[model samples]
Target: MSKRPYLIERYPPSDRFNHWFVAITFILVALSGLALFHPAFFFLSHLLGGGPWTRILHPFIGVVMFVAFLALALRFWGHNFLTGNDRQWLRQMDDVVTNQEEKLPAVGRYNAGQKLFFWTMVISILLLLITGILIWQPYFAPYVPIVLIRVAVLVHALSAFVAITGLIIHIYAAIWVKGSVGAMTRGTVTEAWTRQHHLDWYRKIKKGEIRGHDHY
Candidate 1:
């Protein structure tokens, strides 16, 4: 009988669920935020309901996105720390883009690009949360000074642009990397996929150094 390829669990069901939850909420929040951001995007408000409704729902949805992201961040916090290997991997960006895995360091579960993007999301979301509150109106903005609110508005818009840009790159990378989306959607990846993309992680898994199922 022919032997089947080995498979490895990448994300548990709970983590996958958490990640998808955040993704969904982020989409909603982004659309609603854009609607309130400019007249050009005002048409997007129809997605939530209308202008008045979009204004009301945007901040609430943003709160949900921030809280959900915090949960996801805490879960993956340990994996994202920058290391010497990661820095080296980053320095060899040309090799990475050219599929020269053998020329680069054996990457861990997350690569340098991923770690940097993770931190970008963290900082951007924190800024969005703080600034969103400052300009929230009725409940909070009324008590805040106008000058501070003005500053908060500019910061919030800039933060949102950063976050949206990061997310676009993140999505593109996921698509660029074969089998990456499958790791999250199916909660597993083939042994070959792991070995090629995250060789250090694969070695750790083989030695029982990391958590995950490895079986045929």
Candidate 2:
């Protein structure tokens, strides 16, 4: 049999651009945030222009990351809807972890873990946004009560930590699965690659549409 070529643009240029946009802003926010968290982490402030600037820019960068991520997320959330099949896939996760992938169910475009990450991220991001706004000073803090701001700060910190942890997992997963990074890097994946990892998605890509995972 002739080898199938990798042809579909899995991420497309727009998606890749958004991914990088979120990535850079996330890094900036993380660094500046660490600087504000404690004296030991104050060295990170230097990257943003010393102590004062770090405080000024950290929230700004975080806002940028949040908006960019929200845009990217809205585009992809439909495919991530959970279903009976996804639950079954979760049950077979051990086979997935063991790389006995052939023994597991064929997911459309994303596996159970990927879908879980997607949903978890969405919730965490929403929490971060709402909480961040509450604690945001020179903006809404004066209008809001001090106790509410304190509560918002606690929620914001917790949600940011969760979102960051999920981001690390998302990145690590992209790296772990060969050809996965190619989707974000070059906006495409080989036909063979798509077929091997997401047979149903490959069929749709071959058919010329840019969507998959038609959940019921």
Candidate 3:
């Protein structure tokens, strides 16, 4: 008989639900926003109904995504703060890309790349929200100056580009790093996977220094 792998708790059910909720809303908002952005992507409007419906719903979906992301950001903000070890880890990008994690600094719950991505998402989303409001039709844009509205449109597009790029990289990394998706999907990870990817976190968990609501 094969030995069963030991499992470690990662995200709890609530966290996973929150993550997926944000993810779904993001997809909807991205598609609708794209439909409004360019004629090339206008076909996507059909997914939500038609161009008129897409225009009406995009901002509302964005608001929901923003609120959901706010809750997620608060939940994981503490884990994402950069540290001296994280700096060292960042300096070892060559090792990280080459599957030489052993040669790099011990990783925490998030690696340096993940932390940077988190902050990037935070900034991008904030800019998107601010600029989005400035250009929002019927509700807010009419009160804003035309010059600022133009600038806000530019900023909104740039922010969306950065965020979409970051999201692509995030998805690629999740797939490239085996077992990462399971943390969000199943809300747990194999002990061996945790030890290999986030050794410092694994040690803390083993030492009872990082107890959560869920037990391993």
Best TM-score goes to which candidate? 1
Rank all candidate structures by their TM-score, best first, as comma-separated numbers: 1, 3, 2
Please give each candidate's TM-score: 0.97, 0.89, 0.97
lDDT of 2 by residue, 1-216 (tens): 875453766676788899899888887887677788779989999998999888778887878888999998999888888778678879988887787767766678787888898888888878877877777778877899989988988887787788779889988888889989877897777666778888767777668675522211
For model 2, the local distance difference test gives 0.80
Q: Is candidate 1 or candidate 2 better by lDDT?
A: 1
lDDT of 3 by residue, 149-207 (tens): 99999999999999989999999999999999988998888888888999999899889
Judged by whole-model lDDT over C-alpha atoms, candidate 1 comes out at 0.93
> Worst 10-residue stretch by lDDT in candidate 3?
207-216
For each candidate in the order shown, give its overall lDDT on alpha carbons: 0.93, 0.80, 0.92
Give the least accurate 10-residue stretch of model 1, judged by summed lDDT.
Answer: 207-216
For residue 137, what is the lDDT in candidate 2?
A: 74
Per-residue lDDT for 23-61 in model 1, tens only?
A: 998889898999889899999999999999999988998
Candidate 1 segments exceeding 4 Å error: 214-216
